[model samples]
Target: MTRSEVPSGGPGADEYDVIVIGAGPVGENVAERAHASGLSALVVENELVGGECSYWACMPSKALLRPVTALADARRVAGAAQAVGGTLDASAVLERRDGFTGNWQDKGQVGWLESVGLDLLRGRARLDGPRRVVVETHDGTTRTLTARHAVAVCTGSRAALPGIPGIEDARPWTSRDATSAKEVPGRLAVVGGGVVGVEMATAWQALGSEVTLLVRGERLLPRMEPFAGELVAEALTAAGVAVRTGVSVEELNRPAADRPLTLSLSDGGRLECDEVLFATGRAPRTDDFGLETVGCEPGSWLSVDDTLRVTGVRGGWLYAVGDVNGRALLTHQGKYQARVAGAAIAARAAGVPLLETDRWGAHAATADHDAVPQVVFSDPEATSVGLTADEAERRGLRVRAVDVELGEVAGASLYADGYRGRARMVVDLDRGVVVGVTFVGAGVGELLHSATVAVAGEVPLERLWHAVPAYPTISEVWLRLLEAYRG
Candidate 1:
C-alpha cells in the first residue's frame, strides 16, 4: 500500500462495503446502489445535501427566470397582459425559491437517505488511502472510514471566476452569491456570456435591473452554433439586455456604496454597476481531499478508465464519478456514472469479472463521452444534444445539416403572434444518424426530448419522419427540420 497522510475510519473498525464522499445527487445514487446490492454504505457531505442545483445553480436560477418568462408571455398576448395588472412580484419569486430549496436544508434529504438505509455523515471527508476516508465532522469530531469494496468521490464543481485585475478585491458575486442573494442588484454587470451568466442576466433584467453583459467572444452561447447565438442575442436584445461582445474587462475597481462596480474594458470603455457577476466556467472540487497521499494530486482530478476506475492507481478500487471526475458536469450524468461505479464495486466484491464498455452498461461512462443534453431556460430557451456540425466534420463524419426558421412551422405561429425561433439538425450522412439538434425559441424546452431520443436511439431520418410532430405545435419545427435535411 502507498504511504498515506489522510486518515481512515479507525483502521477497519468502522469499515463499510462502500463509502461515498459528498452527498450530492451522484454520491446519493452511489450509496443507494451499494445498499441495493446488499452492501453497507455511508455518505458524507459538508454542505447542503441537494448540491448546487438545489440552491445555487439550476433550481434557483430557473425560479428567478420563470416569472420574467411568464410576464413576457402575458405582455405579448393582449388580453392576458391586461388582466395581470402591470408586473411580476419579485418578492414572491424569491419566496418561492426559498421554499423549494428548503432554505439550504438537508433535513428531507437526510430522511430519505435514512429511509433508504444509507448512513449519512455531515462532515468533510478526505482520502486517507485507496479504500480509506478520514472525516472531520461539523460538530468537531474526527471519524475515519474504510471501505471494504470501493471509495468513490462525487464532490461537485464550483464557479470559476475570471482572472481580471482587482477582481477579487472588488468582491464579485459568483453563482453562489448571485443565486442566494437577498436582494437583486439594481444595476448588474455580468462578465461572461455563458449559460449561467446569461440566465442570471435575464432573471435580473426581468426583475428590473439595468443589466450589461460583457463577453470576450463576438457572439453569445459560443459553445453553441452561431445561428443559435444570433437567435438568443436577438431575444436578449428584444428583452432590453445591453450586450457588449468581443470585449474584455481589463480591471475591476470598487467604488462607493451607491455605485459599487467599475469595469475597465479592453475597448477603453468604463462600465459602472451595483454588482459584478462572473459566470465564466467551473472547476472540479478535488482540492484538500487527500488525493496526493494516494498518488493523486488534490487539485487535479483522477483519470478513470472505461470501468470508472482511476488510472495509474493500483488495486482497481478507487473510483470517481460526477463533477469530481471531470466528466460531464450535469447532475444526471454524474448519477449515471455513480450507478456504474456502484455496480462495478459490488460485482468486484462478489469476485465477478468486471464488465467494461463505454455504452450504457453497468460500468460505462458512455454518456459522459456522448449524447450529453444541455438546456438554457431563458425567455427564448435553448436546448441542444450530441455533436455540432463542426465537431462532426472534425471527426471525419460525412455530415449534412439543415436549418429552419422556426416561424415556418405552424407551432411557432400558434405559440405567439411573432414567434421568432431557429432550429438546426446536423446529420451524420455516413451513419445516417442525427449527430446534433439545437432549438432556440420560446417554449422550446419541451421540444428537446424528441431530439434527444432521436440522437440517443440514432433514429434514421426516414424513421424520424414516421415520428410525426403534432399538428400546429412548436414541435412541428422537428418535422420542418427533417424536411430541410432531405432538401
Candidate 2:
C-alpha cells in the first residue's frame, strides 16, 4: 500500500488520500482507480458492497427473467416443451439470486477492497462539509474522514413512486421487493410499463402469477420507438401478460380479506391482485447526503463540469459520478463516469496536466447526457442507442428515418420459423452519419454494441455500409438499414 507522507488532520478528520461514498459499481471503480494510482482511499457504504445492481435492480431481476427468456427460446424448438412437465420455480430462482448477490454480505467484496488497500468503512455516510464525510457505522460509532485529494459520490438510485391516491400508505413492492421475494405473488399488478415493471411482470407471470402491466401512456416503453413498443406489447400479450396501456391507476384500495389489493382506474375499470409492483422510474439518492453544505440542494442532483468536478466545491476537491449526477442511472455508465473522474483526480494530484478526449472523454459523461444505450432483457428483447427521430427533430436536426419490419432480415428468419420483430435507424441527413438505432426481436442484445460504436465513433453511413455484419446472424438488419438510407 502506498503511504502519504503528509497526513495532517483537519476539521473532524482522519487522514486519507481519497474518500469515496457508496460502494456500488461506480464507487468500487473509483476506489480501485485511486488505489491503483498509489493513493490511500476509504469507501463508505451503508448496504451491500456490490450495490443495488448486485442485489436488487440488475442481478436479481435478470435472475428472475433469464430463465423465462430461456424457456421461451426452448419452447420455440420441436420436442422441447416448457411449463408442461416443468415450470419456473420462484423460490429456487430467488435462492440462486441470493447466492449470486452473496446474500448481502460484503466479505467477498471486502476482500477485494483489502487486496486493493482501500479502507472499508461499513456505514451510512453524509457529507459534513467540503472534504469532510461523517459515517455512522452499524456498530454505533461515528467517525469523520477528511479527504486530501477528492470526495466522490457514486451512490446509485432508488425506485421512485409517483404520487397516487393512497399510494404512500398502501403496502406495495418496488423493484427491490419484486426481485428479492422468495415467493411469487398469486396475482401481480405492475404499475408502470417501463423496463423494470415490464421485466418483473414477465418474471412473475412465468412463475405462475397472473400479471397485469398498467401504463399511463398509450403504449409501453415510450422511451423506445413506437414499433418496439408494439413488439413488446405483442410479446407480453402472447405470454399472457395483461397489458393495460393508456390507463391510469387513479386509486389504490386495500382489501380486508382475499387477494388484498385492488386498483381503480381512470377508465372505470378495476384490477385486483395479490400484490402490486411500482416501476414508475428511479430517482437519484441525494436526499440525506448533506449536499447543501457544498452548495447543492435536495431534489436537485449534483452539478458536475466537463471534468466531473462538483461545480462549486473548493480546491477542486469534490466530484460526483453515477446516478447521483442524474445522468445515466445504469450501473455500467456509472462505472464509466467513475473511471474518468478517478483518473482525472489522480492526474491532478500527481501535478500531471490531464490529457483530454472528446465528449466521450475522461470526466465528461457526455454519452450519459446524450446518447446512452439501453437494453431490455425480455423475450424478444429490445436494444437502442442514441437519439430517436422525434428527439432529433426536437433538437432541430434535419433527420431522415428508415423503418423496416425485422422479419425482412435474414437474421430474424434464422432465429425462429415465425419470427416477428421491428427495426429502425435514424440518420443525420446533414452529416450522413447514423445517429440512432433500435432493434426489437429475439436475440437483439448482440447487435447493440455495433450501434453504440457507430454512434460513438461517428462512423459515416458509407463507411458503415462497408462494415459488414456477420452472415446468418440477426445483425444483418444493419445492412437493411443502410440500404434503406441509401435509397
Candidate 3:
C-alpha cells in the first residue's frame, strides 16, 4: 500500500511496527531494514531527511575539498605542474558544493523513503513513554505515534561550543557554519585540531582565506599516530596556514556583527580574525525530546548492546543508533548499527532467538569495536583501521609494529614524484594476524579497505604474503610491511 493509504491509529495518531526518530541516514536505514523484514515503519524528521552529512558535514565538506586536492595532486607531477596556471575559482568550487547538497533540499530523499514503502512524517519527535512518541509538526499541530514492535532514536549529534568567557557573544562558527557559509571569511581562525578543524582549515585556506589554526593540544590530529599529525602540519604550513599549537582562546571580543573578532589566547597573545570556528567537539542531540519520560537522561548519550538496543530501558523495545549512541560516530558505522538494530527488532517481534552472544552474528554490530576504518581528508590524508598501536598496547595485546615509507615503494613513486607517506602494520603476536594498520599520505584513503579486511577478517601473516599486491600500486606497501615484519 502507498504511504498515504497506510491505516492510522486514530484521528490524531498513527501506528507502525517501527517508529524511527530522525530521518537521517541512520534512521532511514533502520526503517528500510525493518520494512524489508515485513514490518511497517514510519520515519519522523525535523530538518531535511538527509541530515547533517548531506547538508553540512560529509558531502558538502568533501565537495569543497576535492578541488583543492585535485589541484595539489596536479602540481606535484612535473608535466602537470607546468600545465597548472592559476588559483582555484572559489565561486565555481562553492557552486559545485551547492550542487552536491542539492541546495539543501530533501525532496529526493523523501521520495526514496516512499519508494522503499516507509512512511514519512515531517516534525520534531519526543519519546512520550514505552512505544509512544509525540511529534510537534512544523504547522504547530501535534500527533501521537505508537510503535508496535520498536522505537529507534537516531537523532544524531550537534556541534558543542566550549564555555570560554565571551564565547557566546562572539558569534563564532560551528562546523555547520564552516561548511555551509555563503561567503568565505577573509581571515579565518579555526580552534581545535581534530578532523573537523584540520579539514576545514585546509578547505578555507585553499579557498582564499588566510587561515590560522589554533590547537589547545600539543599537535594536530592527536587521535592518530604522531607522524600523521606531523606530516599534515608540515603540508598545511607549506600551503601558507599558520598552524599554532599549545594554545587556546581565553576570551573573544567583537564590537559589532560587521567587526572582526579579537581573541585573547592562553599564551598571553592576542589576535584578530574575520571569523572563528569552534570545531572543539560534538554533543548528542538529546537535550529534549522527552527522554526523561522514558527513564533515560535528557541529554546523555544512549548506551546500547551489540544489537543496538538501549540498555536500562525496561522492555528492550527502545533502540538508539548513530551518533546519539556515541558508537563510532561515522555515518557508515551508524548505518551498520541501524541494520543490526532493525533485524534484531524484527526477530524479537517474531519470537525468534538471536545469536546475541556471537560477535560475528548477523544481528550484531561487532565491527564497531574490532574494526572501524576512518579517513581524514586533509592533504596528506590519514587513514587507519582496527586498533592503533597504542590502543592495542593499552588493551594488553602482544603485538609487533612494522613501518614502511611509501616513497620507497615503486607504485607510490609512480603515483606521485617524491611521494611522502608512511605505513604501519600492527600484528597480534599470539594470533599472527594483523590487528591494526595506518596509512598517511596523498590518496591513501582508497587503500584503507584492504587493511580493514585484513584486520577484521583476522588474516594471518603467511596467508597475507600470498595475497600479492598488483605491481605499480600503493597496495605494494602491504608486501613491504610483511617483509619488514619478517625481517
State each candidate's clash count.
4, 0, 0
Candidate achieving higher TM-score, 2 or 3: 3
lDDT values for all models: 0.82, 0.82, 0.91
Superposed model 1: Cα runs more than 4 Å off: 1-13, 255-259, 356-358
What overall lDDT, based on C-alpha atoms, would model 1 receive against the true structure?
0.82
Q: Give the TM-score of candidate 1.
A: 0.94
Q: What are the clashing pairs of model 3?
A: none
Residue lDDT tens for model 1, 1-487: 0111122335554688888888888899988988899998888888887777777887888888888888777666657767786666778888988877888876777777877878777778888877889889877878877788888888888988777888878989898888888887789988888888789888888777889988899988887877777787778887889998999889999865455778899999999888988888888788888988789877886689866788887787888888877877787778778888888888888888875554666667666665778888787888888888888788888888789999778868767767788888999888888989988888888888888888887888888888878897888888888777777
lDDT of 3 by residue, 401-455 (tens): 8999999999989888889999999999999999999999999999999999999
What local lDDT score does residue 164 receive in model 1, on the 0 to 100 scale? 82
Runs off by more than 4 Å, candidate 2:
1-13, 79-86, 255-259
What is candidate 2's lDDT per residue for 164-215, written digit by digit as tens? Answer: 8877666789989998887877889999988887788778888899998998
Residues forming the 10-long window of minimal summed lDDT in candidate 3: 1-10
Cα RMSDs, all models: 3.9, 3.3, 1.7
Give the worst 10-residue stretch by lDDT in candidate 2.
Answer: 1-10
In candidate 2, position 478 carries an lDDT of: 86
